[model samples]
Target chain A: MMAADEQQLILRVKEGDHEAYRVLVGRHMKHAYNIAYGFLIDHDDAEDIAQESFVRIYESIQSFRGEASFNTWLYRIVTNLSLNKLRQRKNTNHRITNLPHQSAMNIISPPDDTSYQDVKPIIERALHALPTLQRAVVILRHLNGLSTKQVSEILRCSEGTIKTHLHRGMKKMKTQLTEIKDEVI
Target chain B: MSAHKQIQSQFYDYIQGGLKSDEHSIIDTHLASCTMCRCKLEELKRFIESPVFSPELPSDKLPPEYWNNFALEVEQKIRTYEIEKREYSLSLWDWLNSLFIFHKRQIIAVSSALTIVCMAITGWLLYVPTLVDEKIALPEISSSQFMEIDQKVGEYLHKSKTLLVGISNLDLEEKSPIDVTAEKKASRNLVQEARYLKNQPLDIRSARLIGDLERIQIELATIKDDAAIPRIEMLREGIHRGNLLFKIRMAESMYEMPRLMNVNNIYSGDRK
Candidate 1:
């Protein structure tokens, strides 16, 4: 979204324009949900956090300084809140164990012209096993197609740290996929 | 550079698509010359370029209902925020009107009293110095003349006191036992008083008095043959140091009061 348009929408939302806020949420909901899902690895929790993040954004829209891009700032908030939820879940020993598993044959098999359902579970599991920072780096780099510098700014880290995480994360994914090959097949 | 280092550097550049023509030429030459580096580079390239599957776009699988539901939820949240903002603004307006109706008379009375106090203070500041001068005439001394006279008087007093002590060295300690004892007792009393004052809030008046008593105690100890001299000197030095520190603290306190007062004044002015 053009920054000028987003700023205009934010101003309207602050002035109690529901339509303007709706437009903003409609534009950003998928991105926000994807980011939350990348961290929490559960659809329901991701959806809840994504919704909560929008509500928070609405509440604090007045305080948004235009120094950083609105999308970048929103991503930061969503990712941090998702990570906090993950930490809380871990502390409570609420293991998220409902992820649907599929056999290797089922994943690699042609299924009525559907390619996504077969691979999504494995990919999600691989992404969930990554360290938090590494997962964020991978999602930002591959899924969002953000530059390394942009990822560093959103994560509030140095570019060197982003590069290190990306390299280590990719290597780890390669190793994990090799280990999972037998089970999947 | 070592083959590994050269290859690693090139790999990052190649992955980022930032290799210049010259660097590309170098890499090509290396690839032709070194089989091991070339093989490693090929593996890295293949890994980077390989496609990994991901979830397909939801818009393709799901009907328009999915997006409509999401849009409706967003619209509902926005409406809630709008209602909250409207209610807040209305409450704020009601609060301001109520304040004006309830406190108008009190505010006027306070303002009048404040104006009268300010005028009285201004008049007093203008006239008090003249009134004091008229009531009590005082002598004036130039700075240079005062210093010269003080130095002369101090020298004369010091010489006379030394000469008198020397002449009275005839069992002086025994002849004036009462006076000596009174002086010793007074010194001990001053020390105790200083210790007590040290424990209290260190203000300018207390600190000054403590400094003066400590200086006198130090001088007397230097001239006397009492065992308490060393102990008294230590105490005296401690009190003097404490007074110096207290002086800094007193200045900071004085400065801070004005700062706080200025802030309060600004806030009150804004309220008015």
Candidate 2:
């Protein structure tokens, strides 16, 4: 939701207007989905996280003082849920083979013609390869055009920490994509 | 750091234009002269600027209906969530008000029975011990042998009380078998002595007390090194149940105070 619109909707919801809450959810749901998509690469998982984030926003709206913009607050919930899902996936300790993301390749198949345009699927493979936080930092900064300070607020970290993560992430992306010739061939 | 590494470090900041002009100029100068660093920066830049980087749309598409019904779905979810939460946590007044609304007779039956049972338990505990106390008075000692026997029994009871109190006071934090070895030995021995005392010819109070103390001694003897806290709690519950601890203390003092007065009376008669 936009900052001013969300604040008014929030005041109405707090005053027990359920319709105002529905308006807020409808307005912000797509941005929530995109934010979730940035962190979690799957479209369905992105929708699930976004929906769950809205549910959380509804449940915990009483504690929302609107000190931070609702836009930032919504993004924070989506990011935290994605990170938690990542941690749970890690704890299961499934062995990760050097296999590529099937979802990434199915959509972005390179043509047989030798062009640097072949780098699309390879970039997809590279993007999904980084750790959860690094992937999130890269996506939020590069795709969404969030500043280091903005990314820091959403991820709940210092600006310096966000920069460190963003750099390490971009550097990893550089390493993996540059080596695409060896992997894709 | 080498010029190459230094330029590499600032490359992201340089691309974002976050660097101060002086720092930006130095990196820009290095990049102009350096082939490898410049190539790395270009590659990184292209990857960040790609369709892969800006996937606000998913690579795979979702249904139009999914977006359309999302708010209504979320609102329905919130409504269901509220209903479920209300069912889980009802305020006392709310639950009672609802109970009266739906099932007044059943509520009255349950509350009335609960009150009666609570009162019965309280009255029994209070009244039974006082009646038992009254019925078990000591015999009048008329001879020196009787007095001597009374004195021996008194000493044994005093020793048993001291041991039981000490065992009760033992901290459960002491975990080693050796830490409780003395208490265990004394308690085991007290069980046998108390059993003999229960069987001896005595007033009803003495017999009842010996029985309680024997049970208590057995309770104490069974406490394993590590299970002291729980077993001590069990012992305390039993002691409290029948006012057993209070009776034992009263019997010990009842025997003691008169005996001290008699000694003084005999001494006065001798001086006369």
Candidate 3:
């Protein structure tokens, strides 16, 4: 029954129902952006990948049988595109810049709370310090709040592998935070 | 220190409720009894549940307006892409139409002659095959032969299913406990049978199944005891993507005995 509704939405999108497409995009846009952002660590690049992912979805919605859920399909696209962007960056010999520290400080509220601003960059730095797979596991499992099973499905690994990556990633992040805290104190 | 090490290794999984029931209970009992471990768990919790970690957005949410424009921007880009594609196709047609404008009659005449020549060649090719087909007679196999072939094919399908199930059910987390020698030998045996069966005059579906089966059997036959996790995962993915086990079962039940006995159609290579 859920599948029937999903198919109906897809069919409406295929039929050029603009409102239906909008609804579909609205439902997943934040997640798609955040997941991409988690990978790219740059807002503009994340937004580009997210929009491109949706466009690709719209173009190919005709071929999408309800085999995987729409969320899975969208995430797979987002993940692949983000990975491609990373690969392209590597091939071009460009260093992956750290998260935009000043930009982060500007957006985190309440703007007067200096401590919150200081800690945000530390968290972002610790997140970026982990290896790519571990970071991806962290973002998807913790930040995105996807279940371990869903993360495994999206990442195409066994659930055991996902759990291991999550465990390692969290441990590393905690270590980084503590080390930094001790240094500051 | 040793005891704490064992329990502490599980602290993250414990906090996440990712432990199995027995493990969870073990952690629970230990935490209740050990004040030091309880403090450790509290510290871990405070660290994880810190406000820095719980923000809905990883960094910060963009102003609401940025999100409001996001969907519209995607739709507009799609429209632009569609328009560009249509215009590109239109330009290609215009180019072709322009090329044909000058020598229209000559082009038409040449095209007509080419079509007629192609048709004559195709008709001759189609006619020549029938003449050769009329002289060839397909030898009839007796019922006994059909039954023997069916039995062999059925056994092959069942064995293939068993092998795949074993590989699929392997507990990957266990440290290399696979009976690789036994699996490799079974695959080798299947490969030998598959090669012999591929030459049989079977229906198209059965033949295709044999072909796919042979490919995977060869993959299995090559697996070493020290095969890497990625290699094992690749094999698993191949089986899953092809849906091979289910197809083998279907061929076993539906195509083996009764379908093989329909000798005339089977001999003619009829496809379902």
> What is candidate 1's CA lDDT for residue B127?
99
lDDT of 3 by residue, A79-167 (tens): 88998997898899866554444553265345576765667666777887789889888888887877777788889998767767876
Give each prediction's DockQ, rounded to 2 decimals.
Answer: 0.21, 0.26, 0.23
- For each candidate in turn, the TM-score is 0.56, 0.51, 0.60
- TM-score result, candidate 2: 0.51
lDDT of model 1, residue A91: 97
Instruction: Give lDDT per model, in order.
Output: 0.63, 0.71, 0.78
Model 2 complex DockQ against the native: 0.26
> Candidate 2: lDDT of B174?
51
Best-fitting candidate, scored by lDDT:
3
User: Which pairs clash in the backbone of model 2?
Assistant: none
Off by over 4 Å in 2: A92-121, B1-10, B16-40, B50-56, B90-272
Candidate 3 residue-wise lDDT, B1-272, digit = tens: 36765676567667778678998999889988999988877876777788866645743457667778989999998998899999999999998798689889888999999999999999999998898776444636787887777788877777777778877876788775455666677778889989988876677998898889888889888876677455667888999999998888789886454433422221122222
CAPRI grade of model 1: incorrect
Steric clash pairs (candidate 1): A104-A184, A104-A185
- Backbone clash total for model 1 is 2
> Residues B131-226, candidate 1, lDDT per residue (tens digit)?
889755553556676454434333322322222232233233343322233334334444555555455344466356455654554444344444
Report clash pairs, candidate 3: none
Tell me the alpha-carbon RMSD of every candidate. 14.6, 15.8, 20.2
| Model 3 residue A96 distance off true place after TM-score fit, in angstroms | 2.6
